[model samples]
Target: MKRKATAVWKGAGKTGKGTLSTQSGVLKDSNYGFSSRFEDGEGTNPEELVGAAHAGCFSMKLAFVLQENDFEAEEINTESQVILEDGAIKEVFLITKVKVAGLENDKFTEMVNDAKDNCPISKLLDAKINLEAELL
Candidate 1:
């Protein structure tokens, strides 16, 4: 149950360039560099990738939690914000919106909290993580 990705960098500092690839080829040879990470550029960045992973992980875990409790959701949308401060990742904020029928607010909040705390990505992150969930 292990996965891997590779990053290759050429040159140094702001002018440097790199490529990111994953074992599954989802991001094969994707371009990333200082501009992509620090400014508006036409490529993906590490923080965005981490945000995507966090959103996906939290949503999936929430789905499982709902199913286990005999509840179902029409849709679940999540957005993860990665905050970089002092040249380091400082916080991750997870914002979730769910469309569910006949689910109690307290129970839904409980499950969301459970997913936020128990998701594998959440567990792996070393920074502060916060969740803002809404029922729609």
Candidate 2:
């Protein structure tokens, strides 16, 4: 099976006010533990959450880049696919899109790379990162 992570961003970065979600369906007022072996679980595992964080962080980082460039992204969506190999996270595939006016593909790609390279999550991982980006 494959695990994936995704995040979406809209409008300005500062304009983003968000909510929180817990894997055990909101651990509020509840005891938490594991129910299954390493093979399975009732909730998500660390790998999935890591991918999800990478996606969210990438989107926000891209948003920051846009805002810094005096541009506002109408929306941005990013998906990160995490691959585990040899008992380690081997690679991450990032697919992302941005909708901003008058932005060249080259510069957009540059900014995307910048975010991919600089996001805290990305910095934490020691895997090869590949990206596909689109500007609309």
Candidate 3:
């Protein structure tokens, strides 16, 4: 299966404005500008969108991993942090809290690692990835 998204920009960098649309229509011509990306603005940016994708992908991966291990989690909350350095995305840090029962620390860590390694977004990203998982 293939997924697609489109970004249209007008004007030069640092002063340009753009809109991003996804095939799913979750974001249709959403606003993205220099201020939105570099400064404070009331609109979405690429990093934020990437964070959303990473979070969702990791959660799904964790769910499947847990199921395969005969464990079930009440919820998996993940926060994906994207770092922009030298005009490029440098790293992605994932902080996750897993609400699970009947699992030991070692097993939980193993499952988390599996998810981190198997998530589609994590696999696609070239940046360094970090993960923190907790059971509660």
Model 2 segments more than 4 A misplaced? 1-42
- Model 1 C-alpha lDDT per residue in residues 6-45, reported as the tens digit of each score: 9999998789899999999999999999888989987999
lDDT of 2 by residue, 82-130 (tens): 8878879999998998889988888888889999999888999999999
lDDT of each: 0.94, 0.74, 0.92
User: Each model's RMSD to truth, in Å?
Assistant: 0.9, 12.5, 1.0
Error of 1 at 18 (Å): 0.3
* Clash count for each candidate, listed in order shown: 0, 0, 0
lDDT of 3 by residue, 41-135 (tens): 87899899889999999999999999999988899999999998898888999999999889999989999999999999999988999988888
Candidate 1 weakest ten by summed lDDT: 34-43
User: Which residues of candidate 3, in runs, are more than 4 Å off?
Assistant: none
Report how far residue 75 has shifted in candidate 1, in Å: 1.0
TM-score of each: 0.96, 0.71, 0.95
lDDT of 2 at 46: 50
Q: How many clashes show up in model 3? A: 0
